[model samples]
Target: MSMRKPLAIFISALMASSAANAAEVYNKDSNKLDFYGKVVGLNYISNNKAEHGDKSYARFGFKGVTKISDQLSGYGQWEYNVKTNNPEAMDMGNATRLAFVGLKFADFGSFDYGRNNGVLYDVSSFTDVNPEFGGDSFTKEDNFMTGRAKGLATFRTSNFFGSIDGLSLALQYQGKNPNPHKSEDRRDGNGEGWGASTSYDLGYGIQLAGAYASSNRTDIQASDKNGQTADAWNLGMKYDNAQLYLAAMYAETRNMSHYGISNNRYAKKTQNIEIAAHYLFVDGPAEGLQPSLAYVQSVGKKLDPVSKSGDAADAAASFKGGKQDLVKYIEVGTSYFFNKNMYTYVDYKINLLKKDTYTSATGVNTDNILGLGLVYQF
Candidate 1:
């Protein structure tokens, strides 16, 4: 062909190739990475008005998955809190929560390590539908359950026995650093513990799950007893649909000591049972609303009264109270979700049925609490 003809054909081909390349980039972007974050702020009133305050937190996160091959791929997630506010008071800048890194192996399992909520807290969250505020709501996550340890690690399975589809198992390991200054700090750098849990979806929007975990600490002290240890476990079930959800959970804690002459001496136990329900509605199809309610009852038997005492020794002295059947709490809470990412909540709790109080080592009933707040999550 003539040189001029060849040059014209080349220019046309180049234009067509550019258009094709643009189309390919748009289509292949399905595998591209992404990032997301949220900031939540709210003000609330408490039973003791003096305890009322504002709550705000900033969350930043990143997630991505790359397909290495047909049956193999890589996935990861990193999330950190940019802001932590004081709900007990009008203070800002507290501590970052839930910062972790996870790796996934398709069809195999996944491993995650770093600062993450404990398995106990995870189970509690799975059951609670109501929003939480400061120390008033059970869904706020008790210190013993939500606190993160430094040497924490978790592993989860992709599936179970090739059947029971959508079923997975999670194993967790946490190292504790017991600080003499902290009252409930169970993270002992020397003491460590591990646990495993199994969960499965039954299809049709329903799920069943259960988990058992036990941790032992060497420097643990109870009453006047040193080398004290505790074991915990949780069981739960859930049902869900486009309209409603029902969840129930049971958890227990048992204490043991090695110094005591009596085999079961210095041994104490605490049990918690909770139930929750959530309902969803479409006001006009364009807008939606979700409402939820939950109740929790905690009972203790032969519980060491020392738990409430700031002094470990004092708490230990109150450990064995007049009646082993002492100490209990009943709580109820509700929340309304205006949308998937924003909501408001209210909660009431009674620390009734106490065999002893901090003032009376023998036993005493405590005060009640009421709380209301709002939250937004992304």
Candidate 2:
């Protein structure tokens, strides 16, 4: 009875039959077309870069809607992500996670344009609940709360002053980027962003989230052109009772800059945290499985310079030399599940280098990471 125990008991009873009922539609008269996809693969290891690897991928999408009359409705999605790592270059060139189009105002909510995801990434994607991997916060720093800002544009709302039960709201923008992001090592540019996010579901399981964003040609330096600015904010909490689940998140990033003379400085200040809990074992032998744990603590500094000083001892003599910072760590293992589109997992991460405070005991442990993966969302 090996072979993953009959494919984990045939994916815990016929995959709980779903895939959104296998979308693929094409209604005639009223006009409708649908299709969707998802796939992720992994097999990796790292004891601070010892290296071991495996990869996989597949992602597809397409959607449609039409009913411009009975109160408006029109939607779309064209997603992309395909690269079998490298089986003789099975690469699919550029990756487009989501292409959008929308207009749905049945109860007053929806407005979209090309290149999706903003709204501070829909409130930090709800702590990014790890399914088979470590939680993600806009890939760590780069996202900085702009949350997938790819020439985006958006607006969403529902349950604002109407009832306020499980309220919702989102707003975003990222105009101007027609090939204006450059890079040498890393200091690309092109941004004129705006963002907002909110969520509430004070139900028995509790929920609350928040977000904030700002941008101005986000550049990581290399002489920040268009003069930097990338603000961010976040908050989170969650508690689910489908057996057990918990969440936490915190974010803060500010990258204000102005070249020389320490003008409006900030140069980058950061803080990020993540936490999670899981427990699901519905039946026997880990029926449908689920054993998860996650934690992330990121702290970065060295640009406060007296909080953008305005003469606080002249910013303490510009730090009188001596400052270095970096920190990130986490341990997450189980993320088991064979339902909700299948699952599997493992992960570990650590990196410590904090020189003038924030103890790491003389620092030594480096970029450690180990990962195991699988995800099958169709």
Candidate 3:
């Protein structure tokens, strides 16, 4: 069996999902290295003081691959991000976004371990293609196996063991991170967890995907007696072709979605939905321009009533079983690409959630937001 076909497919898929247009820096003796980075000048205008400000950032990463043999290969990637809005003397809020290494066994599958994206992102990513903000229906960072996090072992296979076409599957396991600091947010910590995802291309640029993840909550997280475990599931479909893209997803979570300032409260149950569409002009004066529209909403059910006393016992005692809207907005945007490595975009989020007691007490932002950005990647 030839390794050329499977290896090419794998590499193509990886590049399609990458945020940068990587440039090959080395390709000798079956070892290859690529360098990629992006700089973005961004700002947001909103009624909420916290949300209105400069949001510029700089990100860079490297990817390397080595062909060990006809049936084996090794690969690794590392990415870092730093906020550029602050002064040089202040803390820039730097962080590592991805750092992982893996081995691929030609037509069988690939296994990797380290800080990486959660398996559930496979489905949610379909609708997360807006110019600015869009994936907030039910996905969040450092919230169990729902988004990006630390300590994950992932195994993925494509083409269904080399027999079926356009089919892929993935399985993941996460180690416990017992964040012991009491002052820190507990939502960032989690216990043992596992996840699985699958996707199939039905042909003609249509695809279907689904994923599920479950994890145990830390001791401090469950101290309030809300729930001991967090679980989430998502299903999505998308159509992508030469000139148009459309996607939609529906998701549900139990004891996984966070609320309130510092994410101090957890919702008992939540339901979310997102839909997005974009069209590109391949020719004429509108060439290189794309317009986007999207709708996203998330609702929490059986929420614990908040208390003004700031006492845990009082808040728990006042729980009369409530429900509230967490996020609701419509996004309209457009991006014009000067070339493959640079673009400018403007996105506006039309807030739909009414400003009321529930939203005010929970610190939910109901103000409309306007974002403008210019990006250069290579």
Candidate 4:
């Protein structure tokens, strides 16, 4: 009788535990998971010295948020490419983009640890369309944080200070991996960086935003040689209405240092300013036809460095370092929306610069591009 009583007690505890576990999963107000991604097809024809690599690709991602309590929760995202040319993939060679997990508290803020966008890229997003697929904008020209691979851990705080009416702040930590080269290159090893930004909405589809970032790393071995600290900063504003949209961004480079090559180190500091605006002409006269026009300009300048170098090579290569004299672009495109989540576009872009230093055609010489593409989002 005594043994049976104990057995009954154990069974009851097991049932209670199982019930609690099931309740958590099917809870009325728990954290939830969402999936999002897109498939992209592109046809790029360059009028310059570059070649067109036409292809189709898709990306898939998952995001989840779970409520731990009334004031705290956990969130994470994992994203990767579904299809791509083997060598065309970016980051980790996995076709995977970002994989990170973090904790979130209502008024305290959030912290994430894993592979993610650098502070400069995060800040850059505030300035322009961030056309990962390719568009002509100033953010696209900066080159420092444009196509970057960074391994990092970061944290962000909520708008406790009310710096802006609706502002939030975040800090990032990026460690530099060293190249087994010279001592000047050694300083680039085990580097660290940080950033800050604020975003606010002024009502009626208008917003203001800004961001900054810096990093130190070993000079990546390349044609141009020199190793020094590298960093960038940017500020931008954006606005949108039913028929028109505008975006502008300004960025500066402290040194000509990136991927380990610091050739223009003492040459000069640089800045890039870009602006783009689009106006809708037609909504949908046909079942799937909407047209728009966009204009983009990318401008740059070199500032005198604090140090003076008498070498003629220093004077010539240091000032322009093979970047570009200037670039301006105009585009007119039509978007056919299948629904709210899918569309196709054909945009013809023209370069208005007189210089031929930068060309898209490698063997040939052209300065224009006609692109046709389709996009599907979820």
After superposition, candidate 2 runs with Cα above 4 Å error: 1-62, 65-75, 78-113, 117-133, 137-146, 150-174, 177-284, 292-301, 306-338, 341-378
lDDT of each: 0.52, 0.59, 0.84, 0.52
In model 1, the worst 10-residue window by lDDT is: 18-27
Q: Give the poorly placed runs of model 4, Cα more than 4 Å off.
A: 1-29, 47-50, 82-94, 130-148, 158-164, 179-190, 219-227, 256-268, 279-327, 353-366
Error of 3 at 140 (Å): 1.2
In candidate 3, stretches whose alpha carbon ends up further than 4 angstroms from where it belongs are 1-16, 180-184, 308-321
Report RMSD (Å) for each prediction in the order shown: 13.3, 19.1, 5.1, 13.6
lDDT of 2 by residue, 38-153 (tens): 67798666653435566566777777888888878898777777766666645554377677888888877888888766666565555555554455533332242344446677
lDDT of 3: 0.84
lDDT of 4 at 305: 24
Candidate 1: stretches off by over 4 Å:
1-33, 47-50, 66-72, 82-93, 133-149, 176-190, 220-228, 256-267, 283-287, 305-338, 345-377
Which of 2 and 3 is ahead in TM-score? 3
Q: Residues 1-378, candidate 3: write the lDDT tens digits.
A: 333333333322432466346889999999999998989999999989988999999989999999999999999999999899989998658889899999999999999999899999999988888789798887887788788888999999999888899999999999998774565456688999999999999999899999999999988788768778989999999987745788999999998898776587788899999998877665667766778999999999998777544543564324344788888999999987666677899999999998676665556788999999998888
Model 1, 1-378: lDDT tens digits are 122333323322321221111111122433645555556665545443434565557766655666666655555545565445555554455444555666666667777777665666556655554455121222222123333444568887746745557887878887764644354333222356777777788887676777665666445344435335566677777776545667788776665211111112233565667777655554444223445566665555554434334354664535444234333445556655554445566666555544344324433334565666565554
Per-residue error for 175 in candidate 4, Å, reads 1.7
C-alpha TM-scores of all predictions: 0.69, 0.32, 0.92, 0.69
| Clashes (candidate 2) | 0
